[model samples]
Target: MRADARKNYDHLLAVAREVFTEQGADASLRDIARRAEVGLGTLYRHFPTREALLEALLRSSFNALAARADELQTADDSAAALMLWLRETVAFTHENRGVIAPMVSAIEDHDCALHASCVTLRAAGAALLARAQADGNARADLDGSELFDLIAALAWLREQPSHAPRSDRIFGLIADVILVRHPRPEAPNASGHTGRQPKGRS
Candidate 1:
């Protein structure tokens, strides 16, 4: 690419990231061009579609996430490391609103520029999940693919107007189910009650 063309490309990417982070992956392409002080044709020349732009924006983040997963794989607590990575992934989705759909769609599209990055991200999480299960810190029945599905579902829920205001409580509920341990009954109190008294008698 010519020096001037490379400059435009860099500027467009920077502006697109800001616009998408603020207004989501579906933010106006024209706005991106205007913000970058470029023409719509130039934006299209660099990124033909919203998906293309989003794929470009997310490629770097996906690479970084995979790198983080690598570091976390060696952490002392496998389960904790997996949970931390999941939280980070959730934050990424939250910041890049309207991106989850395209990401999910692109994962299976070989032609999509984001496909390789998406697969790498999933593979990184899968390794962590396997490690946690092998260490007996997490349920063995669940797999990394299910974990990805769960994350995608949660992201979609968070993006919806009705669920936009949800908190960590929702994530806690799902994580509890996925990461539960054998429940030991509580010890009886002095009254020999296991906290099973009727509501009216309590």
Candidate 2:
């Protein structure tokens, strides 16, 4: 694509994603073009159909998430990384509520799940889960898909205006259930303090 065409494509994508989130899968592509200050023909050129646009968007987001999982695998503390990643997943889901609803709705037909992109996402996320489990960090009982779906659900719930306060508690439950080791309760030290008590206390 030419420089201006590429710029228009990028702008249309950004606007479409935001509008879709606000107005759902039925959001008008024309309005997205308007927001992007581009022609309707330009939007159609970039994405021939609504489903094509949705698939492109989902693929883009998943690609970024897969890359982030690769980064987490490189970090020394795999458990901490997994935990942080879960929180980030929740936030992303919350922000992408409009995207999620339509994606789910599309899965009823045999034609759905046609993309191999979901497979790639699963592989990357599973690798991170495996690392965490191998490190004796995460509960072995929960497989990668289960853990991922659990977080995605939490993120879905997080999007509800009524559920904001429960977000922390929900994540807390995830930690409690998923973490294999609880920090040992502190023992009393020389000063007859519970180790949890300030070390400098008399």
Candidate 3:
């Protein structure tokens, strides 16, 4: 990394961050190069691929999130810690808009540039979930991978124009469902049954 080359890399990364924030993860690499006042070849030489560029951009944030998870492990309430981590994870994905697809893909693709970071993040969430489950706060049937999927689903909801406003509510609903202490009570039916009525009957 020569001085000039390093300067270009930094500038490109800064520009890419701006572009990605505005246009999302799938924003055009060519547009990023143009905004950075660099040639497309230069961008490719530095980033190689979209995943590589995203990996470089997200690595620090992912590391911070992993550290945060570790810190949360020592919290007094296991369920609260897990819920906090879940909220932060969902917020992180929402902040990085359009990244959920690549992240979900990266987890299973060992060769992907973002795979390691994604795996570490998932593991962090898993640890939190496991702690809660062990404390009898969270559901025992749920697993880390399922937790990751839930995060992805919530983040995806935040990405949609029609559903974004309801994302927070939906997230709360999900959190309630996951925590044993916060189970949703059955609604009373018209016939005074203390449960949901069958759809056709209703």
Candidate 4:
């Protein structure tokens, strides 16, 4: 595209992100064009559909997240790396709150432009989960897709009109439960006693 066209495209995306975040995924395309100082034809020329525009807006974030997971896989502490990734994922979701609602449906709709990106995003999370599980950090029963849904749900909760700022605390607790190792049952000693012994006694 020409320099001027590229400028308009970028401007449209920035304006769309703001408008969508404020007004949700159903924000008017006409308003987006007005804010970007562009014509409806121009908006359509650059992004033929709302899904296309959303996909373009989110593609970079997803790519960065996937890359981060790849880097974290090589980190010395697998569990810590996964927790960090989970925090980043929550932040990403919070930043793109407007997209979360539609994204849930889009993820199931094979025809949506954002579906493929969501799939790739899930795969990245799955890789991190697998690494943590292999290290005996995360639970073995759940997979990346399930964790992704939980993250999305947390984001949705953040979007609701709540007076208390509890998302971070709740997210941390969730990460602890999902990624940390579960406590094992106590075993009997040689004397066949399961109760705890005195501190001074072995």
Best by TM-score: 3
- What is the TM-score ranking, best to worst? 3, 1, 4, 2
Task: Write the number of the candidate with greater TM-score, choosing between 2 and 3.
Answer: 3
Deviation of model 1 at 187, angstroms = 11
lDDT of 4 at 49: 87
lDDT of 4 by residue, 107-190 (tens): 789998889988888888899989989988988898877888987888787877792288878877888778766688789888
Q: Kindly report which residue stretches of model 4 are placed more than 4 angstroms away from their true locations once superposed.
A: 2-4, 21-24, 182-202
Instruction: Report how far residue 175 has shifted in candidate 4, in Å.
Output: 2.1
TM-score of 4: 0.81
Q: Write the per-residue lDDT of candidate 3 for residues 138-183, one digit (tens) a residue.
A: 9999999999999999999999999999988998899988998956
Candidate 3 Cα outliers beyond 4 Å, as residue runs? 182-202
- Candidate 1: segments with Cα more than 4 A from true spot: 182-202
Residue lDDT tens for model 1, 84-170: 999899889988898888888887898887778888888999999999888887888998778888889888888888886774778
Please, what is the whole-model Cα lDDT of each candidate in the order they appear? 0.86, 0.75, 0.94, 0.85
Best by lDDT: 3
Clash counts for the predictions, in order: 0, 0, 0, 0
lDDT of 1 at 115: 78
Q: Write the per-residue lDDT of candidate 2 for residues 1-202, one digit (tens) a residue.
A: 8998788777777888889888876788888888888888878888887767887777767788778888899999988898887777666666666555544444333355424555555567678889989999888888866775776578677777798788899888878788788577778799888856456787
